[model samples]
Target: MSDKIPEGNRSARERLAQQRERDKGREKRRRTLIVSSAVVGVLALAAVVGLIAANVGKDGDDTASGPAITPSGATGEASLTLPVGASDAPSTLTIWEDFRCPVCAQFENAFRDTITELVEAGQLKVDYHLATIIDGNLGGKGSLRAANAAACAQDVGKFAPYHDVLFRNQPPEPDDAFAKNSRLIELAGEVKGLDTPEFRSCVEEGTHDSWVQKSDTAFREGGFQGTPTALLNGESIFPKKGDEQISVENLKKWVLEANKGKKPGTATPSAAPAS
Candidate 1:
């Protein structure tokens, strides 16, 4: 009945109050810890996202790297000239090709013997304009590097045989394994004396990479579409009018007709009198 509670009762009430405060303190600490953990989780997730984005950006970079293909001034400044046949041959066959192109390989396989015959007989001059359109269209530097090595071979005067070996050892289109410098060097061994130290250095250094790049630019600017583009005296022979396809026989016929009875190795009347 007194205003103050009994001593034992007061002690029990005090203990209850202390226990309730302790429970409240524990709840507050639990909430604080949970919020801190959530914040840390969000930061970690953000860091992971940033790393993924950086990797994607690196993968998408398409900058042209490796080798500089030196433009051979043989056929103007824009072409890598592999002049087969007589210097004064009546007809000029200009070929723009990428080593990685399957059609180019087919074309080589179909007409390589004929090309060899004509080139050996000095009936025609072949100007090979190595282009890396495949690298641009399909991605990767395989075409570019292969073209560069071809140019390097040209430096040692072994371009013709080396070029043949390249086509012979060409890897399938998407598998650019053949483009590696080591493989290229191995292919060079097929051509006698092409595996010299100087030649190896050239291939490894990408000496002609710049030239390969320029050749591609020229190919684009020339407005001729696709690889293995065969031009007889500056005219396209592929993609004939209508549904007709260019055949090896027709290609020979076209060349013969273009020759107009002037045999290979003989100087044209316009250039010099036939003896």
Candidate 2:
């Protein structure tokens, strides 16, 4: 969390209230959670138009092109970046998302691994685009807190794990008390190397505001009227009916296709096992 977070934001009681609200009568818990808030499970970086250049889609596989590896050299054990891949790869991919958006979560659950496999195999790099699609709504306050906490986690190399857990047990939309700092800490505890006083302090600070705003601006200025927007290797891919799950199969298809028919550098990741 940023040092700029307002002091009134954190409260153990508030956290408990959030938890209670999440546990009982979920259906009765306003259905505001499903409201579209752009995208989910990403930490979007600000990109300037026209000058952004990427050589992505250079899959490790000989037939499929993965991401471009910048001549500037590799990221070198940079594991703590966003759930999205690091920035050193050849191409830059950006996803504009909101945490409360179910479709965004679907996209993450379906494709995060394919993207990771490629990144680990030295193929693709993804940049998360965080949008405050939840601001001003029921879960708005909580999402704001969570978003800020996410930034704090990012600072301590806990982003990806924190992100994964947040969604794994993510509560319904418009009901983000579950997404508050306390729960965020609860989620962080599930990941090794993530439980720390310093880390906790950072999360409490709400540092991701600047980062979240950048993506929010992108969503609005970038022309996204809805949540869950994705730009693969810099090319936008519309979600299937906006209700479509970004399963591993589909993510690979788009990633592979973005390479312009180039073979995947690694064995094509096993298709999304039928679920």
- RMSD, one per candidate, in order: 25.8, 21.3
Model 2: per-residue lDDT, tens digit, 1-275? 67764556667667888988887758554443443222321212111110111112111111112332111111222221244443444444566556665656666776677777767754566655555555533324554456556656665555666777776766766576644678878877888877788767756654445444444444455655455666666566544423543445656665555555443343322221110
lDDT of 1 by residue, 10-126 (tens): 999999999999999999999987875664454334334323322231221134466544533345554455555567887888888778766677668767888777766666778
* Local accuracy by lDDT, each model: 0.68, 0.52
On lDDT, the candidate that comes out on top is 1
Give the TM-scores of the predictions, in the order they appear.
0.68, 0.58
List clash counts for every candidate, in order. 9, 38
For residue 12, model 2's alpha carbon misses the true position, in angstroms, by: 75
Lowest lDDT block of 10, candidate 2: 46-55
Q: After superposition, which runs of candidate 2 have C-alpha atoms over 4 Å from their true positions?
A: 1-88, 240-247, 260-275
